[model samples]
Target: MENTKKKRYVLVSKTVLVERELWTRVRVAAAIEGETISGLVEKALCQYLERQAEKYGP
Candidate 1:
């Protein structure tokens, strides 16, 4: 038998205040991409961090 397990992450809820127009744009983009706002934000943040790491060493 093989054991299949998944790593668990502890996620925290956060409240962000953005401009109404910006929020609407994000919502539309998320809908177009078939992703939740949270997922889009996470992916954007990860990409930003990767770019930053490349610019300034790991």
Candidate 2:
């Protein structure tokens, strides 16, 4: 029987570009944190949403 815990997420892919220095910084930070660039970007976007919500609460 297959172990359910062995299943993996099939990540959907996308691409975006940044200035060279920022790209370098992101790559270094991702590597240091053992996270993919996508993971870092996703977390950044969630944080951005939180800040916006705080600024414009309903």
Candidate 3:
């Protein structure tokens, strides 16, 4: 049998302030997409970081 190890990540809570209009839009989009605001934000952030890393250095 082969052994495998799973990678673990730690998630931490964070507070972010956004404009009222943008926040409302995000809320509506999240509901329509069936995704949480936190999840949407996390995905966007990760994509942004990946682009930046590719452009610059990881």
Candidate 4:
């Protein structure tokens, strides 16, 4: 039975096949940062982009 409850929003939807140990490490890192794995990855990527922009700024 599927619940008809509404969700807040759709963030990320993807599929990846990773090793159990690597998945565990990702989960632990997300927990320590108080974030979902998606959130952690998104934030990390955004920060990296900003740093790159600064380095290449006009």
Q: TM-score: which candidate is best?
A: 1
Measured by lDDT, the strongest candidate is 1
**Candidates' lDDT values, in order?**
0.80, 0.76, 0.75, 0.77
- TM-score: model 4 vs. ground truth: 0.55
For 1-58, candidate 1 gives per-residue lDDT tens digits of: 7778644433234556665667778889999999998999999999999999999998
Clash counts per candidate, in order, are: 0, 0, 0, 0
> Which scores greater on lDDT, model 1 or model 2?
1
lDDT of 4 by residue, 1-58 (tens): 9999654433234565565666677779999999999898789899999999999994
What TM-score would you give candidate 3 relative to the actual structure? Answer: 0.65
Query: Over 4 Å off in model 3, which ranges?
Result: 1-14
Model 2, position 12, has a per-residue lDDT of: 37
Scored against the true structure, residue 25 in model 1 reaches a CA lDDT of: 82
Compared with the true structure, model 1 gives a TM-score of 0.73
Cα lDDT of candidate 4 equals 0.77
- Predicted candidate 3 versus true structure: per-residue lDDT over 37-56, tens digit per residue: 88987887999999999999
For every model shown, what is its TM-score relative to the native structure? 0.73, 0.68, 0.65, 0.55
Residue 6 shift from truth in candidate 3, angstroms: 49
